[model samples]
Target: MGEPSAPGTPRGDRLHHPQLTTLVDTARFHAAHSPQVTAVVCEDRALTYARLHRESNRVAHAIRATGAAPGARVAYLGKESEHYYEILFGCAKSETVLVPINWRLTAPEVSHILQDSGSDLLFLEDEFGPVLDRLPTAPPKTVVRLAEGTGPAAWTAGHPDTDPALSPTPDTPVAQLYTSGTTGLPKGVVLAHRSFFAVRDALAGAGLDWIDWRAGDIALVGIPGFHVGGLWWATQNFNAGVTVASMRAFAPREAIDLIRDKGVTTACVVPAMLRMMLGEPGVEPDDFTTLRKIVYGGSPISEALLEESLALFGSEFAQIYGLTETGNTAVCLPPADHIPGHPRMKAAGHPYPGIGSKVIDGEGKELPTGAVGEICLATPAHMVEYWALPGKTAETLVDGWIHTGDAGYVDDDGYVFIQDRIKDAILVAGENVYPAEIENALERHPGVAEAVIVGAPDERWGEKVHAFVVPVAGREPSPRDLHRFLVDRLAAFKLPAAYEFIAHVPRNPSGKILRRALRDRFWNDADRKVN
Candidate 1:
C-alpha cells in the first residue's frame, strides 16, 4: 500500500493545503532572499528581513523556555508595533498560536478572551497596564511587559546580523484572530500557516501585481495590529521581502506625513480613516503620491467619496471584503473597478482565484443571480476552527463552507452587492428595509456628512426605520429637507420614521458602524438581545 499521508499533510491538492506548520519556512525564505532589506520600520527602530527572522527565533526560544507546549496559545495585547509582528512570527516559529487582542476592547472584553484562550503567556505593551490590571486573574502563565526595562533585553533587541534556526511545520497554528463580535462576545478564529500564506497569493491574484513587492518596496502598516488588516498585510509584505512601516498609533496627519516622508508604497485603511484624512486641515493633493496602493474595506464607501478620492489619489484604490474567520479578504474589488463605466465598480468585485463564493438561502441551497441571501464562501484561507467554541464553529463552518451571515446579492454579471447584516434587517410594517440602502441614499445628499439607520420599535408597525445623521460642516439640512431629498430616491415605506442629529456616529476600530450600540439605547429593557 502507498504510505499514509503524514498528519497535517496536504490531501489531494497541494495548492489548497493548510499552512499551520510552515511558519519557519516562510520566515527563512525571506531571510535568505532579502536578508539586508528592511522588513519592519517602527517609530524608533528598523528591522531587515534577517533581523526579523533572528529576533523572531530568539523570541520563539524564549517562549519555548517558558515551558509553553506546541500549539499553546500566546496572547499579545498592545497597539501596533514591530514587537507585535515579532511576537507573532516568534509564536509561529515555536509552533504556538498567537492571539492578538484588539486594543479598542474594554477590560471586560479583554478578560473574556484571556480566560477563554487559556493563554500560556501574555506579552503586553506598556500602555495597556490599566487594562491588564482589570483582569480578574493573572494569565495562566508568564506576563512579559514590552517596555524599556522589563524582561530580558535580548527579547526586545533587534537582530541585524544573525540567523536563528528555523523550525515550523505546515499545519502548525500560526494565529487565532478574534472576530469583532458586534452581536456578542468575540470568538477566536484559528488560522494555520497555509491559510495565512494563501491570503498573500490571493492578494497578488487580485490585481496587486503592480506592488513590485521585492526587497525594495516599503509597506506602511498603520491599522491596528490585532486586526486582520494590520496583521495579514504586514506578514504578506514581509514574506514578499518588502519593508514594513509599523505605526504604534493611528493619527491621520501623522499617517499622511509618514507616507510622504518614508517613501511608503503600500497602505491599508477603512473608509472612516480616508474620510478623516480628507478632512484633515491643510491636506493637499498628491499628499500620498508615494503610496502605490491604498487597500480599503471594513465598510462601504459612497460614490461621492469614491469620486473625490479618485480625483485626489488617482487610480490606486482597491476594496477588499472578508472577515477574521476568513484569515483576511476573500474577494477584492480591483483597481480596474475604479474605471468609469465598469459595471462592477459599484459592487464588491469577483472572488479571488482558488476561492469559491455563492449567495445561499436558509436551506444552504445556492440562490440564482440577482437574488439576495447569505454570502457563503469556501476558501483555503478559511480559519481552521474557533477556539473553545465548538458549537459556534460548527454553526459558522460546514463542509468547508463558511457562512458569512452577511446579506448580499450577486448580480447577473457576477458582481456582489452587500446589503446589511441578516440580523440587522429592519422589518417595518411587513416591509423589509436594509439600513445600508437607506444610509447610502442619505449619504448621497450633499448636506449629509454621515448617517446610520436602525430599526426602532413602533406600535403601528413592527419596527420603524430611524436615522441618526451627522451634518456636514456649516451645512444644516433639517429632517424635512433630508426626507425630501430621499423621497424621490427611495420607496415611501423605506423613509425614516424619525430623525436624530448627532455630532458623530459610534464606530469600532475598523470603522464599522456600531449598530448594536445604537440599538441598545432603545432596546435596553427588551427581552431579547437584538430586535
Candidate 2:
C-alpha cells in the first residue's frame, strides 16, 4: 500500500501510479483533504466531500449486501446527478465495475447492454422504471431505485447497507464504457483502475489550471455522465475539491444561466453544443465572464467558429481529442494554442506528454511527418479489453497500441492534423473523399447550416458522394448552386453527385453525426457493406 498523496499530485513522476489502482482512492483523498468542501451540487441538493464519501460507502455496502461479487459488473442507468457519482464511487470501493448506460438508448438497446454485460445489479433512476420492467430477463438480478431519501424507496426495500470496509484489488476492473459502435452493435470497453488513474494523472500534467477546481469554485457539468468526458471530468474536479453543478439535460439557455448565476468557472462541451450556445439570442460577449476554461472536443472546430469563440471568450479555450477507449483525452490543444497566430492552433497540439501516438500505414510502418495514415495510440489509459469480444479486442489493441481508425498526419512541429475516420472515407468514382474535408468546405458556404456527406451506391462508380445538408434558417440554396460553389473549392470528383435537404442532421447523444445511420437508410436494399 502507498501513502495517500494530494489530489493533484503526480505519483512518482509518472503520469499514472502503478499501485494506486482503485478509484476509491480519489474519494479517500478528498475526504481527508477537503472533507467540508462541496463535492457535488445537483438540482437543489448538495453533497460535501465527507457526505459524498459516506453516501458512497453506504451504497457500496448495499451493493455488496445484494450479493454482488467483487468482479461482478453493476449497471447504472440514470442521468447526471449526485446519486450517479455516489454509485460510481461506491462500485469502485466495492471492487465492482460500473457500466453506465447511455440514457439516449432505446429499451432494446439497453436490454442488449444489460444482457451482454451480464450485469448482476442495476441502479436506475425512477425515469427508467418502465424500461426496466420491460426487460425480458427472468427474476432480474436486482434493481435499486434512486430517490432523494436514504433507504431504498419503491424498489428493493429490504436491502441493507453494508460496511464501507471492503478493500479492492489494485487490478480490479472499475468501469465498462460501451463504445458508440458506428459499424456494429456497441461493445463494452473495459477500463481497469490503472487505466483510469493513468488518464487522471495525464490530465493533471497537461499544464492547464482548472479554476473551478479551487476551493469554493463552482464547476458546471452539463455533459451526460454516461460518456467518458462527463464521467471523468466530474471525477477529476471532485477529487480537486470543487463544487459540481450538474444538469440532467443540456439546454443552452439553462447552461448559460447556470454559469452566470452560479459563478461556474469551468465547463466541457462538444462543438455542436457550443454552436447552440453561441446561437442563443440573448448571449453576449460577457455572458461567460466567470468561465475560466471551456474544454471542447468530439469534433474539429471550424476556423470561423474558433475565431468567433476566441473573440467572445478571450483565451480561455482548450481542445481535447480522444475516444472512450483512451479514457477521454490523449491529445490536448491547450489554451496557449488558442492563440490565432500560433502555428499549432490548427493542429491537435502535440500528443499528451506521456501518451504515445503515431501516424502509421496499413502495414504498421511509421509514416514520416506530413504523411496521412492511421493514428495509433499507446498509453496506460488504454482500455483493458472489449468485454466478451476477444477477436475484436485483438484486432484493435495490437502489441499495446490501440489503432484509432482515424486518418491524420503529423507535421514537422509534431502537431497532429486529423483528416477523418478511415471507415468514414467515401469512394466517389474511384476517388477517395474524406467527408470531413468535404463537410469543412460545405460549412464554409454562407447558406449551409449543417452538412453530412455519405457514400451512396452508384452503378458507374463503386459509390458516389451523397450530401445531406441542413440549410440556414429561411435560406435555401439549390443543389446546383451548392454544386457550383464546391466545384471551385473542392475537387470536381469530391462534389456530391446528389443532394438532399433535411430539417436536421441525425446525431448520436454525444453530438457525433450519425453518418452510419444516414448510410444505412440509403443502402437498405444494397448487398454491400460499404455503400
Those runs of model 1 whose alpha carbons end farther than 4 Å from true positions after fitting are 1-21, 148-166, 202-215, 340-343, 425-531
lDDT tens readout by residue for model 1, 1-531: 011111111122112212323667767877876678777888767877787787777788788778888889999887776667778778877788998887666566678789888897898778878888876667556888888323234553553323345466555678887763433455788988777577555544443442225435677776677777777777777666668898877788888888888888778777666767778898877787777678876655556677777776653777777777777787777666766556566576556656777888998888887787888877788888988878888988988888887788776545567755665756553334568777877998999999998887664344689999999989979999998988755557678999999999999999988988997687777533222
What's the C-alpha lDDT at position 285 in model 1? 70
Candidate 2's displacement at residue 388, Å, is: 1.0
Kindly list the per-residue Cα lDDT of model 2 for residues 58-133, writing each as its tens digit: 7777777778888899998878878788788888888888999876665655787899899979887778787777
> Residue 1 CA error for candidate 1 (Å)?
38
Total backbone collisions for each predicted model: 11, 1
How close is each model in CA RMSD to the real structure?
Answer: 12.4, 11.6
Q: In terms of TM-score, how similar is model 2 to the real structure? A: 0.75
Worst ten-residue run, lDDT, model 1? 1-10
Runs of candidate 2 exceeding 4 Å displacement:
1-21, 136-139, 147-163, 203-213, 341-343, 425-531
